[model samples]
Target: MEENTFKKGLIDGLPIGIGYFSVAFAFGIFALRCGLKGWQAVAISATNLTSAGQIAAVPIIAVQGSLVELASTQLVINMRYFLMSVVLSQKLKPETTVLDKLIIAWCNTDEIFAVCTGKDYRLDKRYCFGILIPPYLGWTLGTLAGVLAGDVLPAIITDSLSIAIYGMLIAVFVPAGENDRNMLMCIAISVALSLCFFYLPYLRELPGGFTIIICAVAASVFMAVKAPVGGDG
Candidate 1:
């Protein structure tokens, strides 16, 4: 039974692994362009498992932002993971130990969270590890390739590949936005707020990380007030 669960996790994670490779490839190229070493790029992917946050950090790092700036940026950009982790904890099997949960939490990316939570039963450590391994490898390998080839790759190709991450984000959100009104509304709100922040002179000065945090919080609050779930008042 454990073997079956592990195999099932690997099977379900295959698509996520493919997606990670494509997205992380772009990230690797971007990181190299931002002056990170090949090994550093690979380390980032291996340790962080986040595209948007890492990409955001590159420019900040290039600018030699202070530790506080880096910490705040990461906090705002990756705050969703904290919420996801809390939700995921509920989906873990009762027998899953604290250490297992800690390790699983460290490995939890958005895709991994989705797969683990989508399961009909609570997830075990083995199944969670099985699901995490392929994508982790794919992301790390892709980053390594990008870093190594960054100088060798044509400018046009690298530029084009950089757009892949945005495409992936759209792919993740669009389907749910199509099926759910609240999701669509929340997306619209976030986009509108982001644009406002971008164009408005005063708000435009805000850092990208803070902009994302404000937009996310405002949109979520609006959505909750306007369309509370579970028929709650």
Candidate 2:
């Protein structure tokens, strides 16, 4: 039964796996450029499952950044996952064990979360595992290819390929945009916060993780207060 469930999850995740490959490939190339060993790229891809965190960490890795810096940076960037996990946890069945929760938490990338929880399917450990493993493998394999290939590919080709991951992000965000007014407002707030962070020297120096928390929490709270129960406006 678990095997069949895994097969179903694999079939569902096939398109997502293809998209993750391109994104993970870009990360591998960036990791290589940052002077990481090919295996290191694979390791990070396996563990991190986050593009922004990996990208942010590259500079830290290059500069031999302090542990504090690395921890703080990742904390700032990945703070959104806290909210995402909260949302996902609510959708899960009550019988989900602590071990299963551990796996789900580890595997809840932007893509995986969408695939697992966006549908009405009640998720269990087997279902989560089936959904988690393939994309993780695709990401790991893509990074491996990038590191091994080095800079052999033409700049134009690589640049074009890099956009595939961003395209996936848009696909994730766009659906939420159509159905969720709060999401649109959150996006607007994010953009505004980004602009402020870029131009304001004081804001620029603020920790990235805390900045995200502040912006997300403040915006969410404000919107929750302002918006009606039905989410009008």
Candidate 3:
């Protein structure tokens, strides 16, 4: 049974593994262009897997942002993961161990979490780690390859492939988003708030990364406040 489950995870994970390769390749190219070493780029993606956070940090690093600002920025941007971790913990069985949780947590990107939470996934440690290794390696290798290749590709091709990460984000959100009204509302509110942040003078001038945090938090709080009580339809 466990063997079959692991096989299922691998099969389900294959497409995402390919996409991660391409997207992480873009990150690698940009990182290298910004004067980071290939290994440094690979290490950053492997540990963080937070593309927005990484890209934000790069410019801030270039400008030598203060340590306090960097830490605060990362925390604010990554706060959503705290909510995700809480939801994921609920899906885990009672007997799930500390070691198992630690291993699984390492692969808790948006894509991986979608697979784990859909229906009765019963995601054990072996299945979690199995799904993790291939995609993780693909990301690392793509970064390395991109750095080594170094500017051979034209600008248009790079720009097109840069959308791959956005594609991954849409995939992660759309499925469960259909069934959950709260999630749908949160997404809609976030999008509306994000647009406002982009176009409204003072808000528009706010940094891109900080805008994401503001929209997310505002949308979440709005939903919590507005959710109907006892399915009072």
Clashes of 2: 1
Q: Give the TM-score of each candidate.
A: 0.80, 0.84, 0.84
How do all the candidates rank in terms of lDDT, highest first?
1, 2, 3
Q: Count the clashes in each prediction.
A: 0, 1, 0
Candidate 1, poorest ten consecutive residues by summed lDDT: 1-10
**Candidate 3 structure quality by residue, lDDT tens digits, 1-233:** 33425776687677778888887888888888888878888888878877677776766666677988888778867666777788788777677899988877877777777666663545566677677776777777878777777788887887898898778778778875697888898899999999999999899987776688789879888888898436422
How well does candidate 1 score on lDDT at residue 181? Answer: 93
What ranges in model 1 sit over 4 Å off? 1-4, 59-66, 114-122, 231-233
> Which residue pairs collide in model 1, if any?
none
Over the stretch 1-233, how does candidate 1's per-residue lDDT look in tens digits?
A: 23327777788777777778777887888887787777888887888988778888888877788989878888877887887888798888889988887778777888788667656566777888889878888888988887777768777776676666566567677886897899899999999999999999999998776787789779989998998877312
Predicted model with the maximum lDDT = 1
